[model samples]
Target: MQQQRWWRGATIYQIYPRSFLDVSGDGVGDLPGIEAKLDYVASLGVDAIWISPFFLSPMADFGYDIADYCAVDPLFGTLADFDRLLARAHSLGLKVMIDQVLSHSSSEHAWFKESRSSRDNPKADWYVWADAKPDGSPPNNWLSIFGGGAWQWEPRRGQYYLHNFLVQQPDLNFHNPAVQQATLDNVKFWLDRGVDGLRLDAINFCFHDRQLRDNPAKPPEKRTGRGFSPDNPYAFQYHHHNNTQPENHAFLERLRALMDQYPDVGALGEISAEDLLGTMTDYTRPGRLHMGYSFELLTEDGSPGFIRRTVEELQAHMTDGWPCWSVSNHDVPRVVSRWGQGSTHPHLASQYNALACSLRGSICLYQGEELGLPEADVPFEAIQDPYGIAFWPTFKGRDGCRTPMPWQPGNGAGFSAATPWLPVPDAHRALSVATQEADADSTLHRFRRFLAWRKRQPALTAGELRFLDAPEPLLVFERTHAKQRMLVAFNLSDQPQSVALPDLDSWHADTGHGLLSGHAEGQRLQLPARGVYYAVAPAA
Candidate 1:
């Protein structure tokens, strides 16, 4: 039973369908395009593939604003195409996980349309609706992560509707027991269709504060994180009342129970509450989600101290729960550019990949990450994301990291016959799959080699992790499982460095992973710029 659980210590590759590939010639990627690329993805040695939202939607927040939970969006393909894609993925020995955005639905959804019609409709209490104040002000001081007030006026109901994101995506009232069962029924539909897993989006925001209380103010000095700009007002509040309610634990248990009925299926929740570490621990405890991940490492602070402290803090909080670590996703800039300080270093991508996978948790490697793709330069005229269009120059939106994957060295890069929704970066053309397939020392090849080798090492996969104290530019850790113990060290710098080993008699270097080379001799070990060292010894 333990070995049959494929999600533990697995590396999941996230596929942003819009930018992965396109076969319909409709200027957008679809299910058929993903099915066409299964061979390429399975060759990377990943255990599963997580496809982002392809559900029916208006594309207001892209596919995150789901209109129909049980059907495929025509922009992507028909339901048959999705079925075919699932069959192909399973045949390739890869589990398929789809995104589930149950926190909210598109305003265009039939349920939302009916709920907003009148105060006494059949589904009137389906969404969070509240009466305005005597002065016609919003019901509370809650703010949207995208912009100003979280409430919008609904003239028909004579009330305000809450939306933590864009106005088109309305928040659902999970306080209603009926709403919870409906969401679970939707999950049952997919599971019946042979889906292996679910990646829950904004799972922490499913239940808001029922009292409708105003959030407390946050000091200016304390508003530096949460992946928002300093100018964005959403970061000015403590965000206490808007999300992360205690009621969420009950819903999680219900969802987990439903998943437990199906063999080998897991739920990986995306949590970003005011206290991310604590929430990660609470949400993934026994009888809850199988795994949880946050945006701690996805931020701009990638220093050695910050990285070590973040992991150590989370480890302290999540003593028994499972965690999933990722540095790049559809939301933030690529790790190569973000961690490299707006510049590209030769071995930085390899070092980042190895370090992230070496951590004691499951890993999520975003599309194009293996190619070391940098953030693209999408001009204002070509921008389509409302988030980018809203904050024009100051904080250009997420389009830079969501460009189409380059597959060849030509103009189109074989992504599509028609122009993609987003432009493929010219710099990425050199790192295309075809170009890298022929090069022996390309980042793509190194990624594959490392993953293939890491699969054989039990200590590196499902073992206990202990950090060995080291200065900046050096992250050292030890992993032990039963009788197998492994020591891993990474130099996240552009200059050469050396570290003294504690147990010379017990350690021998492992050079099989084959990305960076480090020389080990006696008590002293020399590592080149952006290099790593791996060694194994008997369990202490």
Candidate 2:
């Protein structure tokens, strides 16, 4: 296969290190473990793998809080281990994209340590610091994404520092030219090391309102919870001044310039904002990020109307910019459980899985998505995510989705010799890689088939999306290129239904043949409950 510059049309897999595999008996995942599994990952037919942060950290926010921008964490293995993993993945024709945390740094970082040492220190201005008001309150009324006021008072400097996340993860003042340059340099350091691309974590939060103005309270209806927490007060405000600032565009362009220096190195931004679709559009225009994705499909809704509406909105809003869509990742519950209506019906699972690829953008498949793995139920004691711990029961935390990948049915699910970090769900153990690998009709097998089939269809991969009008519970659309046109229809219902072709002379049903399981009808197609169909329209 030849390489392409635009990875926006690519399928990338996300790997959560601690829960992926524990190569060493330390009961934690390491680089060597990921390297060893490259073959398994490559077999999935995805274009690349976006490995979660493996940098030096106290694991406060897992790898999100960076202690060192350049060094691999000792727990994840030395830098040499990462090099080995990178080399192996490249050799297997798989691109490696690493997560880059730019918005903040751990308080333990040398810069923060030095800056907080004293107000007159050389690095004192490296981070955002403000003096308390006469009343001894925070400088302004900004709140952290994890809850409470964003400002943390530092007794040493007699000033408060801003933290958009955990108190330990202090927000870096990107408004400072030095800080921006330093962060860009860190990105170039990795680009020079042969890494294929970067997945910018919290890109919108890189810049904040310079004025530190108070954020407005969100309307009662608009206060539907975000990733911070369900009951966390962070959800009450509209987050106007804290994040999604206008200055992020300037920083993104600078980062883009650095990435463009390398021929094939790409950048994908993770936009977590109230107006995600708008943010994605702005971030992915010509000179900004190569691609971007939002949390539109990550929620618990999977109705055909919701899916169609999301794609329609993106198509209308995202003009020249490309889109990368993912329904589940380490942050959210698996789609199988999220949208499965609490049933393990194979048809429903297959329908949802197909919908992931049918959308008009690059697709992202999390580690265990192939097995139709439902979200694991981790007891409160087993929960390790602080974000989840703070809002237990109401939001059970992300640990359920971060469980180790089930490679086999043997001890530790063949992920490690000792006990794994998170317990593997019993339901997932039976649907292990070994079991699915042997079943030709399994979801894993369908993914490989779909990718292989989709590769040959330029219309499906690189063409434009045109939504077709249809009755409720039916998603109808067409993906078209120069001379090829593919009509994709999916039945999101449990009961059978039929869709009549509006205007067609002849059509060939390609379902159950190409691109996973779907069929075609001459003019009218009948769909089984939760069934999907992909057909090719005859030449006009």
Candidate 3:
């Protein structure tokens, strides 16, 4: 296989730059900090590291609101520091993938500043700008993910500029050829700098309805999968006019073409739409993105049936397209915290890490997931995420998942000498890296073991998945590659369960690094709580 195509079934670890580590004693993680920890990250056995945005930004939406796509944020070190981080990671045999927020930019960006100044400037049409309605209202009924209307009035231009997120993060006008070319040019700058992959943020929001059509209303039942709190009014509509436009495909094709010029470069898109599975399929077609992931598995549901059905649906739609699965990221609550229901369960984390990696597609493991860290309870006073601050009491913001990583047991958690950007929860301290490294049965060790073992199983890494008929609390599937076939089963609940299997005469159980041991007796398989079973059969 070619080196650039390594993401086919690879596991990529995600590092939230602000929370990973801090070496400058500035209370925030920087590129030098990430460089210093490259060895530890490589030890996790992940093939690549997909870092969140570290570009120059005004911090309105953190790094997602980029002020300069090609410049490194001062808070995160200089461009030279990033070069060192990349060099260090490559030396350790880990590919580096950085975030690229192309759909929008911080209002303070030079392009946006000039575009919003006057309608006749050279960069006037660089961003999504439209005339107000007869009554001086927004151009359309589209709503912002952070709350309120998606259109913000710019008195200087006498028009409204669109912003799917916060007012400070304005959407780019991809309808303009110049805007698309400029975005592609910005991407090439990074490609020349030697990044192995790009994780495109909010990729579907690149284009909008040219006619400025009003989006139809959405019922409460159909508003759950758009990657926002149900309490947010942004979920009340179908979002037809605001995002997931057809014209975005052309832009993606252009971006992919630019990437094709550089060997071993991959593009992963973050897509969230009304029909997320269908959209993921469309966005990752042959000439488009190499892979895409949505909020399907990131929701509140973690049941066996839901997981099985979600994968089955995506597999059905994505015949030639590749899908990426992530159980947790910087945007959502930690998987252990979300699925564990306010409790910490090392067993659940172990099962989740295995299941995510064993799926039929690539995997993205978030920071601290290996430690089985639950979501921190960031108080309102400590909240820094604008999305969370906007919907405070009803839905606490994402600050919980963005807290600093706990490396040790004492104050500062070995992350920094000063008070960190976010408080390190006491619960996380109990599961710190230092503590887990000493315990043989810790989730951290289990994670490392599973990844090492998984690398040796071709059927688990790059095989076709077929789900077997199993009841609740039991997820049974088969992965086959070439002539190698393996039967994989899991008991998702805390209660013991048993499933009838075919004749066991031709099968032998393979204990996979003691993740969870299950046994077979005759034609029945016995699985304890959160148990896993992997058996191999001779080629027919």
Tell me how far the alpha carbon of residue 373 in candidate 1 is from the true structure, in angstroms, after superposition: 0.1
TM-scores for the candidates: 0.99, 0.96, 0.98
| Model 3 vs. true fold: TM | 0.98
Per-residue CA lDDT of model 1 for 107-226, tens digit only, reads: 999999999999999899999999999999999999998878899999999999999999999999999999999999999999889888999999999998998999999998888765
> What lDDT score belongs to each candidate, Candidate 1 first?
0.90, 0.83, 0.89
* Candidate 3: tens digits of C-alpha lDDT, residues 158-230: 9999999999999999999999999999999999999999999999999999999999999877776534765
Number of colliding residue pairs in each model: 0, 4, 2
In terms of TM-score, which candidate is strongest?
1
Residue 5 in candidate 3, Cα distance off native in Å: 1.1
Q: Number of the top candidate by lDDT?
A: 1
TM accuracy, model 1: 0.99
* Cand. 2 Cα-lDDT: 0.83
Error of 1 at 361 (Å): 0.6
